[model samples]
Target chain A: MDKMVYNFSAGPAMLPVEVMQQAQAEFRDFNGLGVSVMELSHRGADYMAVAAQAEQDLRDLLQVPDNYKVLFLQGGGRGQFAAVALNLMGKNAKADYIVTGQWSQSAVAEAEKVGQVRVLDGFETTGNGPRALADRWDLDPTAAYVHYCPNETVEGIEYHFVPDTGEVPLIADMSSTILSRPIDVSKFGLIYAGAQKNIGPSGLAVVIVREDLLQQACPHTPAIMDYAAMAKADSMLNTPPTYAWYLAGLVFKWLKREGGLEAMGERNKAKAELLYNYVDASDFYSNNVHPQARSWMNIPFQLKDDALNDAFLKEAKAEGLLALKGHRIVGGMRASLYNAMPIEGVQALVAFMDRFAKQHG
Target chain B: MDKMVYNFSAGPAMLPVEVMQQAQAEFRDFNGLGVSVMELSHRGADYMAVAAQAEQDLRDLLQVPDNYKVLFLQGGGRGQFAAVALNLMGKNAKADYIVTGQWSQSAVAEAEKVGQVRVLDGFETTGNGPRALADRWDLDPTAAYVHYCPNETVEGIEYHFVPDTGEVPLIADMSSTILSRPIDVSKFGLIYAGAQKNIGPSGLAVVIVREDLLQQACPHTPAIMDYAAMAKADSMLNTPPTYAWYLAGLVFKWLKREGGLEAMGERNKAKAELLYNYVDASDFYSNNVHPQARSWMNIPFQLKDDALNDAFLKEAKAEGLLALKGHRIVGGMRASLYNAMPIEGVQALVAFMDRFAKQHG
Candidate 1:
């Protein structure tokens, strides 16, 4: 038996062991300062360097362009839902939304209070497997921007391609998909991600916004949501989640240590395939996500017999697999194979799933 | 000499050594769970249990009543500046503010955007000091509530008196004062504190709102900021800052273990008095705040000879008294005395200050 259980629960999912250890070593007193990193002022030279380094590391990882402002703002992706509307929805504005699942739908609902938000497309399947049936969007010519959650935690849906927006701004909520793979930075006007999953922790949301879109924020937007204010203050308009920012920088460093996003992406693909391919070969266990649109980060599946679901879960737990229970919104089993979950973990999961399937069948 | 220097940055301030060590030990895999708390889903049983326990511990510490909802919201004290106005400034509403320093003045600015706001009084003596001028007040009888910042971080000001307003609700931005001492929770209708100083981290802001005030949020308020929605969700309607929440819970446990607010309050008072008294007795150093209204959390003092400021700072840094520089708005030195700062730190600072004063005087 392993020293600890294999965690399959999606974000605040897992981080590299080395990052945690370094953070711990610095916990009591940073660089002999005798105070934890949490004790430093957000605006102090010590903490500011941490923030700048984090932004730099992220830019290096994603190859984020110079024109875009990378902001480590507070509130989660939930905070961004309203902030997006309040910031982007301005005079004579109607934004387009792709309702992939719960998160995108929530975004649409929040956007409704600020402007005329029209949904163009979304995922229809319940979990992990997404059938993007966006009945060809009729985008408003004068719309402020287009919005979509690139990955939905609840339904486990993912976008395989960046939606083409022509000259219009393309905004993607890459809360889960960020750092899991690489994407073209020039294709989108803005990209925002909550840090809990792929970055470092919750509380911190990373927004990469093109300079041109900075002035379009709605007048009623709070100063924190005002990109101009955050940019001007260097994301220190208020005391930011300083500790989270530092931890994220550490995670970025870890990513760099592991050979950046491209290498991490390949590792993730391999892990996802190991589980999905195994699930497909056995009828005793079933995965419903369409093969073409399957998410490489989260894999949700179920036992053929619902009656054995409890036994499967219990045995999985006994074997040290944790948080495999699917989201209550969609009941079954979900194995979120984020970057931290090695291929070895996937192999272990695959082995266990097959064994359980044979016993149930 | 001590192993580490004393840190006195107000918010995003110092945390206990043990908590950081625990975080470090479990950074990569909490309890051998093979995942950092940062990556764990807020809804996962592990993180959920953490969220619940953190809240429970907080509630227990504050002795929060059943009717008072404790919410972990984002943005910083600055986010609350806007949110408080939008939530409490209901139909035909006007709010009154007592401007003490930078934070309160900012709150008034935010409140003005929502409705008619009155600056009831200012305790400032020509824009700098640590006391509220109690004599000047024009509090409006028709105002829905009276708002004040109990502790101003930059100016080192604190309110010694709670104003009587017949039936008007008192709202306080206790960002710096919270957990530093015990207070009567029933006296204020709403109290919000940022988690940087004296608490845990920078991302999570703890809001203790009375039930009656929860339902008064404006029509245009976002769901995440809507107090009623947040209270109903138990601070989890959206994905929370999971690792921060877990760390905060650990801090709460630490607070209880170190002995409740009373013990904490005595230690805090002693620490503040030690530094302040040393500064007062020195001809070379002086604190501008009114003696009675001085904040027990933040002590700002200036050297009599401005020419020696840089040398003093350099020498102090060499001696391991870090972050003693005052804010840019007010030049000199400011020492934030939070719960985690031991008396030994204060004693060390005073001893250094006295020796420096004797040599430099």
Candidate 2:
């Protein structure tokens, strides 16, 4: 029998086991149609039902307002960095970006290509060694939008509270934190998440945008990237990533069956806390981010001795804990406890770390 | 026993039975790692092998020259419409588009937004009702590139020969017809195909661009859409459609096992001939495409009586022949014989068409 395995990749991360099983079972024959759901045309009734249900389920899970448009688009979070700028910066041609970490910093680079961008620091070094989220930023009342990364996947930094940008539309790149918990959908003007993490799979991004913000896209914006055009067509402006969208629907159904985002939020919190608690208690393993700012989804922890990093990863892989290596820029280990990751996986990682620590210590 | 099923959806269409079965068997535990391939990180060695192998196999299949870069990207064929214009128009800021059908016309619209566009009619009305491919176009030598859709999926039109554009790069959107037959890769400056039809799933697009054409992308082009940036990163500028890319790799392997594009071309020709010959022999059903310009991939046929359309579709579905309805713009039925479609399926379709005609006649 195969041993239990846990994947801890930051994005293109794990999906619910139930969702994966259902998708596998129906990989070839969907709804007794004897054809793979992926084989169905996007415009056809069969695939359309799947697409609409996925969107509706996502809406229900998030409690999205009727005035908002949930777009299942191609390109990941990076694509949205440019798309957001092109779509919203047409009239105003300027925005304020909160530079939190690698992701928000990348957003600024893309936004600068289109129009004026003012970068605001998202964090400040506390009196202690760890960094904390900045509570306030200089206001840009006339800006088109205030874009920020609610959860930075690379650095494992996240904001617990939504930054208020009164009168200015607040946009969050929720690629890592989305669906891990419920948020007040009406609070933000737009929220975009790459489907690799807390959603379904790669090749699909979910954009929840207020209806009023859909207009004023630059004329030169690619139709595929134009939010207004995509919103009007219900995100089928072109052939969407159909199979990913279908798999996303299965994931949504699974989420609904597991008592929606409320249940998922509670479960995700418990999972994140299990690892963070273990790391805090152990001198052998340490997470550098401030307790309040540490990500609930991606938890980056380092061993006390950097020399043992290779051995730790090797030993962990032998025990079926995969993809624990952190981003090269911040080397150590990252255990991404996305919505799909059960607490058991975190427990296993903690157990492995304890075993490794004692042998090395 | 379950009846045999044949799917004829134009895109997100039928995949090889062998590939689908293999993928299904291993969907949950890729490479015996006990995790789906979709869950694998693009940066990881496992998935990078998969990505690289797919590109290599595609290169091998096409005999692509060393001077070109093969990029697996997001945003489908329509995304490429904008990408092509944005990438190529930076230097010259103008291009000639040979408008063949709906697809090429749509390309013109996207290109017009990016730069100056000249639409050259791709077809001339023949003495008969059918349209023939125009031999000569008012060429623009100073233009950066000349773009055309080799196969129009909606209208079932195809170019039998490559157009000569002296000193200017020629770009072809082979979304519907790519990998169905072999072609000279060296002839064109760039060739892109949306994966839904002849490749794998919907989200991925395969772009083969000459290295020389990569550098001229507009300053504001999204990094995800910029060929030079994507090429440099090996199409990993951001999280790619990992699962779709894996599936495409499986497809490439399957194509190689099936004796590459040479074998696929012969089989496709036979499949096209079978359907076209059957339609030509029948008075009750007719194909409007000129013989010389008929698409080898998508064949649109009309019944003598439009009243029988719904009945025909219903009856076809009952027999496990699915998605035969044509694009709304072109009424009737479209049978897309992509590479994954076997000769037996075409034979089954012809047999069904014969049975439907006699009963309705």
Candidate 3:
């Protein structure tokens, strides 16, 4: 066994080993610049190269249209929740939010502060069980935009269908779901993802917004959160999350080398299937979420015998698996299989689970 | 000369070599935890240690009073401009701003979005000249707070005296000035600094706000931007910039080991004086700012002959002194001497300036 364990955190989850190694080597000096990437100015040639390439790579990966402005922002997923509302809400504006999970609820609530918010109640959460189909969404016609999250980290629910809001724009918080599956950027007016999971680190938030949406910020919008100002400044309205941008750029390159999103989606799907299949086959363990709504990124399952919860976690840690304990909001074990987690890691996890289950059962 | 060049960019400045080395060593694996700090969940025990220690060290360095809360936030320094107004402008309906330079102007513009803005204009063009002092400032009593930046990074202007606002809380954006000198925490109601310059990376913004100022956030503040939410969540309202926070902790240790703020202040003073004295003595180079208001952190100077600017920059690069090229807004060379820049780097810059001046003259 390796000296260190495999960590399965939800958001700030595992990073690519090769990427981490490269980052480690470049921590003191970057491209003969004689200083760490973090130590370079945001506007300098060195960091500008880092920023430019990152945006290009992301655009290429997502096939982001020319009509969209790619923005690198801060304040994580939560910060973007506020930014989206402040930037999109205009005079006499209202937004329609599809309440799929925690993030969507937060977004709708935050938007209500700046403008009117109408929850669509799109996906139903039955004791964190199977989620409703996206076609069942009840969107408001008066909305400036319809907001939803493609994937919910804690509830492990993902939308299989996209809502057609007609002329109204679609905004998605793809913090957990980005890069894990193929996405149609043209379908959404705006899409923002925190960089902690599939991209790189926690500091940078990436926003892909259609050009038309950029001009409608509420008069009271903060300049940093103003989409138009950010697009005008090339996302350097202030000193950006430089190091995070650099790292995400590297992750983008890695994604390109690994055959882009289609390939990533297949691999992620396979990994999730492997883990979920194992859990389903065993009478000792069961996944609570409906299979159709199940997320490929986060696999949340609970042991049939509740008494083994502590023992399961303790033994899992002892066996070199770490952070498998589910989120406090949902009690059980959650194995978040992000892009970085190879198929082999899932196999290993399944093997460990099988052995532990056979003994505990 | 040392193998590495001195970085003099205003922001995303040099970090301590020890901290860099430590980061490099621990980049792939943090404290034998097997995953990089960037890969850990912000709420995890290990990362919480990083957050706690970073805040504690900052408190120790500032000798912050118990009533103040030091928050680690995102959106760079510019983001804080909006967050401050969003959180602090509730008590009264307006905020008073003392405009010193471009950054202060940005702050005033942002605060105008949330509440009424009272602009204190004299300092922008002439207050920090040879005849000015901080005591002569006219402040508003009904204003929520009087905001100012102690140092104008681009203008190379520094405040020698803290403005006394009496019952009106004094809020200063110390993004470019913090950790360069000793500050009495009790003097200001709130102090905020961007981490890129004197602290760590660009993603994290450190805010030191008095306790009494925490509660009056506008009813609908986002969890991440709400000062009370941040204080309660310990700046992990969402996942923080983990690695940046960790690096800051190392910088704090380095500061304490290097004999604390007094020792750092002495070195900074000496470094600034060395450059200023050279500029004053030499006819080839001149700094337009009044001597009393010249900044210790950023020293902006211009060559008498603008034609030599290109040659000066090229020669400076060849001599291993970098980022001497000034901002486009302020057309001249700017040498940012942060805490990490050793005394020898300043000496080398002065010596290079002398050689260049002698040749040009």
Candidate 4:
């Protein structure tokens, strides 16, 4: 057997080993169709069944309510940044944005092209560090919707609590943190996650939106980006990313077999704690994100001797731990432990970190 | 070895067996990397090399001029419909379309959503049959571009000659016919094809656009859809459909091994002639498409007795000649002889057709 390395790259991150194996087995033939799933026609019965079951499994896993529609869309998170503005900022033409980190700031930039955006809160920093979420946020009650990124992968910050937005719809870009834990599905108006992170591959995006919000899409919204049109066509407005969708379905099945999101949350929390606790205790390494707001999926840390960053990454890679290097914007190390990453992978990473720190110190 | 079946899907169509096997071999690991290519960071040197090489191979295979940019975009053909309008239509605010069938009609509809669309010609049939391309067309010299589908997958009609569009840029949706033949790159302003048909998978669309036309994209174009932005970013303005792009690179290499587009065109012409000639000579079978305009990639035919349609499809599936049923809009049968479909597959199909007709007739 080939040596398996633990990959910690942030989006397009790790997928379950079982999912990969099953995918390889079915790479040539899917369910005796005599053709790879990638070659199956999008409109045919076989592929349609795969698409439908994927949506149903996702719905079941999330316990999504009846009034919401789960759409398997294309264009990734970036496309949806523009799409969300076009679809939801209709006649109102105004939306409130809460800027937390790199992703939310990027969201604000894209949304600004389409409408009047009110930055309810900017990334303010206190004397200690980045300002807490509790800082006063000037939200506009009449805004079309409230938008924010639930988890910022680059800054390694996540919202541990859902903001209370009573009547105005709440939209969250859950790209990095989706499926890492179970949350109340009814709390948000819409949740969009690019599949590459927690879901499956690059090209597919999963959007869950309340049905009533569908009709508000602007007239100029591209057919593929319009929520109403996509919902009506069952996200078959065009040929979807069939192979990615199939892989995502396999992942959903794997999630179910591992006892769904609640069980997954427990496993994920334990894994995050194992690494974070180790870093917190070590004088040589540290993470700046407030402990309460630190993400369970992505953990970014800095070594005391900044020069050792390259050497540490090189050593970790040599030990069969890969892609642990942090984002260029936030230099050091970032270990993204998505749904597919096991407790053992985290354990291996922690052991490697301890050895690297001692040798360098 | 597993039973290899002939897949006749019009899009998300057959890929070469060697490509599939190579992909499977690298599914667990790529170039000795512990992670799958899908799991690799798009910004990393390893993946960037993959992206750059894929573009180079595509350019080499197509002889795409330096003045033209090849963008590996997401959102399929449908997204490009809206994008083409948003990007190409400037102050003129108008474009001409030659609607041959479903795809062109759809394109015209999408373009109409963004600006003024003039139907230069429609799919009109006289007592003899569908009107020829040489027939009178109301040309709009001042229009931004003249858009047409070089090959209509549903109608099984293809352009035997490029239209004479003087100064107006000519855009062709070559979704079902790309890479099946050689063509003059300088003849058109843009050629966009959804990768599923003759390229790779469904989610990716390859757009080869002239550099001069890049500057004309409207200010309101979504950054992801903007040709200029994508060109500047090397199609990495955002995380691309990496897996699909990688698969497409493998395809470009395979095309080179099979003697590039010139050799592909020759083989394609012979394969098309073999099936069309057989159909024309058979008293029990007929193809409505004009012989001169019939597509080399997709050949749609009908039985004299329509009652045998179900039986034909059922028996074909049993023979491992799958997805032989024609599109619902244009019913009967369609055998898509994409580059991946060997002459042997066509021979098997032809032999089966002869047997089916003999038994029923």
Which prediction has the highest DockQ against the true structure?
2
lDDT of 2 by residue, B11-96 (tens): 98999999999999999988888888999998999999999899999999999999999999999999999999999986669999
Fnat of every candidate, listed in order = 0.77, 0.85, 0.79, 0.66
Per-residue C-alpha lDDT of model 3 across residues A1-361, encoded as one tens digit per residue: 2664677889788888778778888777788878788888888888888889988999999999999999998888888898899888666678888887777887877788888887777555444333444556666766788898988888888876676888889999999888887899999999999988888888889999999888778787778778899899998888888888898998999999999999999999999999988888889888877666788998889888778989988888787787888888888889999999988788878988999888988
Q: Show how many residue pairs clash in every candidate, following the order shown.
A: 15, 0, 0, 0
Over 4 Å off, model 1: A1-4, A124-135, B21-36, B126-136
Q: What is the DockQ of candidate 2?
A: 0.82
* Residue B339, model 2, lDDT: 94
Candidates 2 and 4 compared: the better one by lDDT is 2
Which ten contiguous residues of candidate 1 chain A have the minimum total lDDT? A126-135
- Each candidate: what lDDT? 0.81, 0.90, 0.85, 0.89
* TM values, all candidates: 0.95, 0.98, 0.97, 0.97
Q: Between candidates 3 and 4, which one is better according to lDDT?
A: 4
Please tell me how candidate 4 rates in CAPRI terms: medium
Ranking by DockQ: 2, 4, 3, 1
Q: Write the per-residue lDDT of candidate 2 for residues A1-361, one digit (tens) a residue.
A: 2788889989889899899888888889998999898899999988899999999999999999999999999999999999999988857699999987899999999999999999988854244322333444676899999999988888898888888888999999999988888899899999999999988899999999998988788889999999988988989999999989988888889889999888988998899888999889998898888766888999898998899999999999999999999998889999999988888888998898889989997
Q: Let me know the TM-score candidate 1 reaches against the reference structure.
A: 0.95
Model 3 lDDT, residue A90, Cα: 67
Top candidate, metric TM-score:
2
Q: Give the candidate number with the greatest lDDT.
A: 2
- Give me the runs in candidate 3 sitting further than 4 Å from their true place: A1-4, A125-133, B122-133
lDDT, ranked from best to worst: 2, 4, 3, 1
